[model samples]
Target: MAEKGMWPVYGHNTAVHLLQRTLPSPLADNSSQRGFGGPRHAYLFVGAQGIGKSTLAQVYAQALLCTEPSDRPCGVCRSCRLIRSGNHPDFRLVAPVNREGAVDRSAGLLRVEQAATIIRDSILSPLEGRYKIFLLQDMQQANESFANKLLKTLEEPPAHVILLLTATERTQLLPTIVSRCQVREMQPIAPTVIEQALGQHWQAEPKQAQLLARLAGGRLGWAVTQLHNAKFDAERQEQLETLWRLAAANRIQRLAFSEQTAAKGSQPQLFNMLEMWTTWWRDVLLAQANCIDACSNIDLREEITRQAAHLSQESVQKYIQTLKRIEGYLHHTTNTRMALDVLLLQLPQIV
Candidate 1:
């Protein structure tokens, strides 16, 4: 059963309601002017990855396509059914692609050729519904040429067409593109809200739900995906165990691990590992402060508390800061080995 005031999306009630108000009433006599003044032709949803931008956009599109008498989407309607099945003729999703035109799995930048293809598609009329929706996922991946290719359509899109773009950050996009659409900034959801949804919808065990909620850092979409990803839990356990072992590792052993990690992994893998390390240290800091309830690694409370007792809170805080700085450098520099070596050397030696 759905919760009170719940629309298809979880959390972000304000965003759902705001979008509902912005849509034209389906009961209105003039259906032809639905996208004219009620909701603008173009919109940009800015937020962190997996924060539900694309999910919300699809729901809003379904509402627009529904033939029902309400402003909201009717799940039973033909249009909504088509959308739910991802077979809607008028809806298109454009994402980043590789050189061969296949969608990139590594989340690369949008290619110029892909932008040209979308421009050609925009000139067409809707095949099955009153409006043609073009959902642009990760517009921040567009380079200069790609962004330029989209300007013509954005400046004066077809009357029957609506453009929806999703980006991790608005600043990553060109100013010209940003100025063309109404911007909607999505914020992080609460852990409690995510926890409740996990149990009710995902049928997760209480402890599993609690752990996922804390690790989610307010992104319900991310949390849900992790539940299904088999490797996620395995990697989490592996990483935590390694850190636990390193707590008592000698200088030679730590340096050996640094060599091995630097030799075997790519820059992206290093980035992810560093993020895990950062979170673990954050838990240690929280444990030191006796903020047990606030710790992300609540399942590892006993280990965290024991470690916290041996480590100074100030040192842990400083190490966290160091990781942040190294992360910034890794993002911009190519000297991966040097950075990883320095990071491992700074690993706190606990008795």
Candidate 2:
């Protein structure tokens, strides 16, 4: 269950304030108004992954249906509880699914059939709640056909129907669809603010919170998730180990590793691993400059320092550039095997 009171959000306070203000005020005169308040029929939440865009959207949906007059979502009312428990009669969430019916991170795709269902469902009156909400997660994953189907609904939505769409970036969506909704761009939270929230609100230990805050890259949701997810740390450690190994690997060995990674068919995971390598090289550059404390991989200062001495600053910087180029191509139309092979060849061998 979500924490009681106002929405339980940590970072992106500005976006939170906008949502609180734009959402229907619960204190309106009941006799004069039929519902809580009039809210925009369509909203597009734009932000990076793990930035709490979906969390804010759900909280706003609760506000649209909560019966309390002063505090919306009272987090205690029948409507609030139903929504939280995923038993709300009028709430619908559409997301991409794999063959097993679970969310697929690497190859997520929202089909046109799902959009058609949403369009058909939007015309009906709410069965229980005051408003009906249709939230589409990862709208960027929707194909051209899906976008066209959804666009029709956004163009002329029912008064009681609220459409919420979340995406990593606005450019990933069609301009016509974007124009039909109110866009809310969420920014990353400051490290200090995240650290303070972890310690005071989440009750995290001081040292752990500080480390998470620094490593989260201004993403509070990511930091908070790390606290509860033991596997997150393990995976990160594995990535760091892979980075150290790759730096010392010869051409034949690196090519073999690349071949194995490309066979996994998990492009997103591979991209993330490469991104970590990029960050590691950047840290090495900082170590070479004697600014080891400023590195994102703060826990690996001694290792970075030792590796920095084996390679010149020019090699470290160039490898960082190469990793970024590879990342850019992988996101689009590029051969994964070919790209990874090139990337492996560029890794500097230790002296």
Candidate 3:
């Protein structure tokens, strides 16, 4: 399903073509950025989580460092292989790390220590490739204090250092940093495209591939990750059961459930719960509208139909808005307990 020469990136072809054009063209001799022809000092890959921003960034780095005579990043080359194995000498991946020191995307914000390392290394030359690439994932998690530390280097980075950053949105980053980079807003991959990739590229079974494509909701990376997560479907089912139980519970019971989940203090759990609840309500709305085929949670069409039968479309819409509001509000508040309480209080009584 991948185009010849664009092996790794299937969803982000425009960005891939743009990066390929910048590879080692005659115009690359100049150190300054030349529109799409020459590489810029910095690039910001913006998209939702589980999108292929990181993948596209790595592919771009491979092409920049690839030694192949033709089709740069001939993935067989030593540089490409090194990067694929996460052992490339000149390529550095910097992201928020948990207390354990391993990279963790949910670790909240990029730390001052990581910025310091990047600033110190910016002056150094490449160890192997012509360009030293630094991939800074989850820039949205970077606080302004830490982000400002790299402004100087980000503005006028060494000609040999190419900075690649990934974030869900540019608005979350400092305006000064945004101005210093070329922003690539990656688009969502179509379900059909993702399904084909699953069957042809990953050799996934046709039926499973079809189901995953619908569940992924246009996120190929999420679909691909689900392939290796043995407990994915089980976890989804658990959330559905919790949702169904809470839907029929009284106000006190609903509030108690929130307290228990919040007391467990797992951010990923809270995220999954909210996202699953929100999307399921959306499916219910679609089902009520007689658009079950267009629902993202089509695998649970029967459950969605049952929910639609019990709830009025108005109440479903209201709860959907409440979920979306809480989602945005949670980004700014640490008092998740209170937010969840408010959210549960607002939900229409299901039974």
Candidate 4:
């Protein structure tokens, strides 16, 4: 998880240390608990899913608003507690909201109304902390109109307001939005590091830790979340097993499975399955090429290795390319059934 006195943000030591160095040091006798040199007006944290972009942003926000003596975020402070509980007046988070007002990331769209509110509220002075922080989670989902409306604020943010944005990729956002904020590209955590943190911090069993670490694919947040979600783990195992079975299943059988998945019509879940499928083949490719060390699904290496031996390098490469194209296509269209059926039709049948 986290280091002592700091937020439970594991990995990204260099980024963490760089962030800590900017805070006002009690030893330096600066009354400004916020920072020595003022923090940037806006920051954009970019990475893949569950890669700690939001968590890292929240930690930085807490550190800025902490009222404790320590330079780092004291999780026990009123400001820190409020931030954690999402009750802090100074810390406002703007994400895509459903009709129910709950976050619905699957089909969520960050509206222009939310953008307007953020821009309007940003001018006010802080209520509790020295600075008001606006956490814009998942900026990529915002339309171009929303991005354009918010561009002015990013270009000239108020001194007392800090905008923290998270996105899967910088390219998904407008170039104008990307250029205004300081960008932090978080890297994947090594499996070894993840295993240690799980064992030492989360008290994960040695056997369990090793598997989750490998499955995490360098995402500490995913590993930590999965620790408590046994049901999801079981589902993942079933999905992987189903993926393998597809290779041996007849075309009609595979198409039937695709039909079943398409009926569910779960965009996020569909994408997740595609991603899992992509990684599975990639691991097989790695195993076939004798680069087993580079394989992510270590616990499933035996089955992956067997398939690697059965599949040709050229066919594997072709399928990987097709899957990539399908992924990009699915993102732009709503024809989930057809897209998934196309994917199933392209599957390489096992001998």
Task: Give candidate 3 regions above 4 Å deviation.
Answer: 26-36, 69-72
TM-score of each: 0.88, 0.88, 0.94, 0.90
Q: After superposition, how far is residue 268 of candidate 2 from its true place, in Å?
A: 3.9
Per-residue lDDT tens digits for candidate 3, residues 1-351, read 567767477777877877776766633553654444678889999998888999889988888888773445788899999998889988999888776667788846788888888988878888877788899999988877679897978877888888999999899999999999989999998989999988888889998788888777678898899887899889988988888888788989989988997788888778877887887888899999999998878678998998799989999999999898988888877888998998988876667
Q: How many backbone clashes does candidate 3 have?
A: 0
Each candidate's number of clashing pairs is 0, 0, 0, 0
Clashing pairs in 1: none
Prediction 3 global C-alpha lDDT: 0.84
Q: Which scores greater on TM-score, model 2 or model 4?
A: 4
User: Candidate 2 residues 249-276, lDDT tens each?
Assistant: 8888899998899888788779768867
Clashing pairs in 4: none
Which regions of candidate 4 fall more than 4 Å away from where they truly are? 1-7, 24-37
Worst 10 residues of 3 by lDDT: 26-35
Where in model 2 is the C-alpha error above 4 Å? 1-6, 25-38, 200-203, 288-290, 312-314
Order of quality (TM-score): 3, 4, 1, 2
- Candidate 2: RMSD to truth: 3.5
